[model samples]
Target: MIHDIAMIPMIQTQADETQKRKWLQKALNYEIIGTYLQTELGHGTFIRGLETTAIYDPSTQEFIINSPTFSSMKWWPGCMGRSANCCILMAQLYSQGKKYGLHAFIVQLRRFDNHELLPGVTTGDIGPKLGVNSNDNGFCRFDNMRIPRENLLSKYSKIDPDGTYHPPISDKMVYAGMVLSRVNTVVWAAGHLSSGCTIAIRYSCVRRQTELLPGGEEPQIIDYQSQQLKLFPQLAAAYAFIFAAQNIHRRYDQIQSEVMVGDISSLQELHGLSAGMKAFSSLATNLGLEVLRLSCGGHGYSQASGFPRIYGGATALVTVEGEYSVLMLQTARYLVKCVAQAASGNILPHSIAYLTTEPESNCSAKSENDILDLEILVNAYRHRAHRLVNEAAEQLKACLLSGKPQHVSWNENHMVLIKAADAHCHYYTVMNFVQYLQSTEMSKPLRDVLTRLCQLYALYGIDNNAGDLLQDGYMSGEQISMVTNQVAALLVAIRPNAVALVDAFDIPDEMLGSILGRYDGNVYENLYKWAKESPLNQTEVHHSYDTYLKPLLHQSHMEAKL
Candidate 1:
């Protein structure tokens, strides 16, 4: 949180030289702990609706910060409760009796001398959570806390001694920190899901179950066709998301450089891409990880399986920067605009140029092999996204035509709009996965295997959204069947190498922390060893058995006799 969320706003998009000298250097060096404090007890995802206030007092040249209501207290910041000494606080700025919108201010929470809460600042742990209890995801409240005017990290916007507000040229610049965080979320999703994938794949390879023939040895679970279906497409997805993250990371770096040089032209485009990818990657990864866990059967339900911890950390990405649905809608907003631009003969950005493609195109596949071609698969995904976006735009247009206001129209059509965003992101993932393989210099044998993975990813996606693909007659029912069959065939072809694919992820056993997924395939022995290490097992019988169990059992026996 300190590195990715807390200190990012100051270092990446704000904080002038003087501000850097004051706080940035020490923050970078970890001399003081920090967190990003934005979500309040009552508000999250809606940045503009935040209630914490930083009222500028010009006469004193200080800002009086207050969490005036219980709901206004900052909540859910990873380290705010006890670990952090300060935060990059998001509060509505009040200057000269005028609200100046949400702004980021570096607020000191604790006195550096002894690490005590500053005067008028009260903060503590938010208590145990569903997961990540080890992290002090804390809440904080301020009772008219005061900080010098210089404390406001002023790069995008600034205020004079007399409280004259000078806003940034682009209002969106204020959200640069969030864009960076969302981009990071994509990578985080891939990495965390990769861990779950690693554990589950290894376990599937080592854990044998059931008998194909009576009195025969059990087969490795990975040999099951159903297991392949569960794991392989998701394995493909981990790669797809990783490649997508790389693409966005490169774009972010380019746009960030442009921002540094006063070119805000691509910021919004980058913002939309990152938002959509963040939503896409996190959702796919979370859902895929859960699927992998379930495939592990009962053991997957245990904390010792490591899915619980991976899930706790990975699922946080869906809601941290912004909730997944909201983020997708933001991307959908951009997509709708692009569709209009395309209709007006405007040149769309390269990433979304597919919007301008002919929407009535039909699949050119006559056989399963034709549909399995990587190019054909990519085209299928692209067509689905293009059509989905157009339909969503038309839906919103119909609502507007029916006398609904823009927001109302948007609300009524949000589901389709979100679907559009989802389709666009899936297309982006498959598209990037293909392009990545094309550019890389891997060996031919490796490339063939990767191409198989990409085909599985695209076809699986197509199979899942078969109705959408069939709706426009883009793909006939026969073609859809071909896609489904191709997916199953790919699964069988990839099964022998499922463990190898996840092994390439190279997550260390220590990091994986899964007994069933250990490299040695010693699951049963390790399970016994791990169970013995439990604190309750230190004695032959737990103290609870003597204290409570004995009394309960004795009473029950006497009642039965009666």
Candidate 2:
């Protein structure tokens, strides 16, 4: 889906016909590994602001690459520190007294013959991280490294012998990779959230707690309303994100196809959508994983529960392709632009038509039963989101007209405007989930489970943002309580299938790389085994014990005798 979208664009741009024949094909075949290297220690989420320079000398016809400062080193490219022989390096281009913006160049980092670092290339693994430590994240600096002109991935831009610059398309075209990467992140968020939900749900089912029913054995924790409230909504979010990711992917594919045919009209929409979706999905998944962890109580804290590591791995996405706040701003900027156009009586684009339109009468629930249906609930969210965005836009306009400085106005209203964009994106995600569930191709059981999950996700948001719902009169005091009750009831219903649900995710124990979240449930044994392997455990006692403890004891005895 959208989350895996980056693999295609990066692979296509970086690898040539010959390189593709030799390495890219093999990498695709899973024989070799590769990763895109764009973000540097000094700069992330800002492509135009990179410091690494690739100065092209026309006389020699080579690009001299340099990382002037320590911070300019490539820092977070997955599998770049090891495993990859090559990388698509982004560097500022300079030649003929003119400077080009950041561009991608395929650089050979290591000798394929012995897998040793190539000349003028300083590179090493970054070692462990918060999670996903198995992947070798690395840092590298170029020491006046020289590469041939052919190294430039010039599918969209190129330079010639005379030092003349030529761009096949707009500068935005070069940034397409970043957009695609963000879209892919959205899809990956769904997977990560699903993994966490599965583990938490299953553990909740098997793990027992205080009996709610008298004369019964201690009840499964899943039966607890609080436990269900915590997990069921997350399960719903997973399903919602899955559908959102798929929809985003479909939109991206359409845009990619159009781009290939020399159409650039949809670039802005794709950029906004992808960026917003990435921000929304990553943040939600990260938060959702934590919720899952907390739901498991003491077990979740144990590395054996697997939630902690999963959470860490998932949380990194907020900063990976793009920072969450920065990407949200990108979406916000686009939304504001649309609002401006609509206020001028210009038609809004299909991607953002929701902003210009008011909620349909059918959008709100008329009866108590309507609250339980996933579609109606999602529609309600969409309506609320639309209203919020429009309200934020109006607020911004009023501030501008009141003679406030543009930056000052934005800063003052930043929180609400950003939240408006967030809610709008979330509504889109929920709606996409509803549509995906209605598809004929889905299996009945999967559809049924996902439908419940979607409902839970929508209700969870409503419950969390109940103030918004209550203020808008979308839900009354009594109806809001009913929402809570409904959510609790669904959690119990989902309890029996928790184990089977998580099992369906097909994550290997090796990939999970956690002692707590092992498939076999031998958490304690694994934890003990892992602890024994630590360097500190290699010896029974330290030399310090003899030196310090013995001396202290002798002094104490002498003082007592005296």
For every model shown, what is its TM-score relative to the native structure? Answer: 0.95, 0.86
- Write down the lDDT that model 2 would get: 0.74
Q: Residues 1-562, candidate 2, lDDT per residue (tens digit)? A: 0112233466564344654565456556644445566546556444443477899989998999986444322333354566677777778889887778788887788876788888888777776778767667777778889998877876677789777888657678877777877887887898888888767776666677777669779987777777877777777777677778888888988988888778988888899899899999899899888888888777688766777677877878888777888788778888888877777887766658776666754435545567888767866787778777877888988998999999888888888788887987978877777777776477888777766777777777877888876777766787788777777766767766666766777778776655555677665676788778877788888677789988999999999999
User: Which window of ten consecutive residues has the lowest lDDT sum in model 2?
Assistant: 1-10
lDDT of 1 at 522: 89
**Model 1 C-alpha lDDT per residue in residues 1-562, reported as the tens digit of each score:** 3352646554547787788878877887877787877646556444443478899998899999887334322333355578788788888889999987778888888888899888998777777666667777777788889999998878878999999999987888878887887898899899988888888888998888899999999998889989988888889999888888898999988998988878998887898899999988998888998999998999999888999988988777777777889999999999999999999998977789999878548999989889978788888888889988999999999999999999899998989999999999998999999999999999998998899999999999899989988887899999989998999899988887788888899888898889878988888898998888999899998899989999999999999999
Give the Cα RMSD of candidate 1: 2.1
Clashing pairs in 1: none
C-alpha local distance difference test of each model: 0.85, 0.74
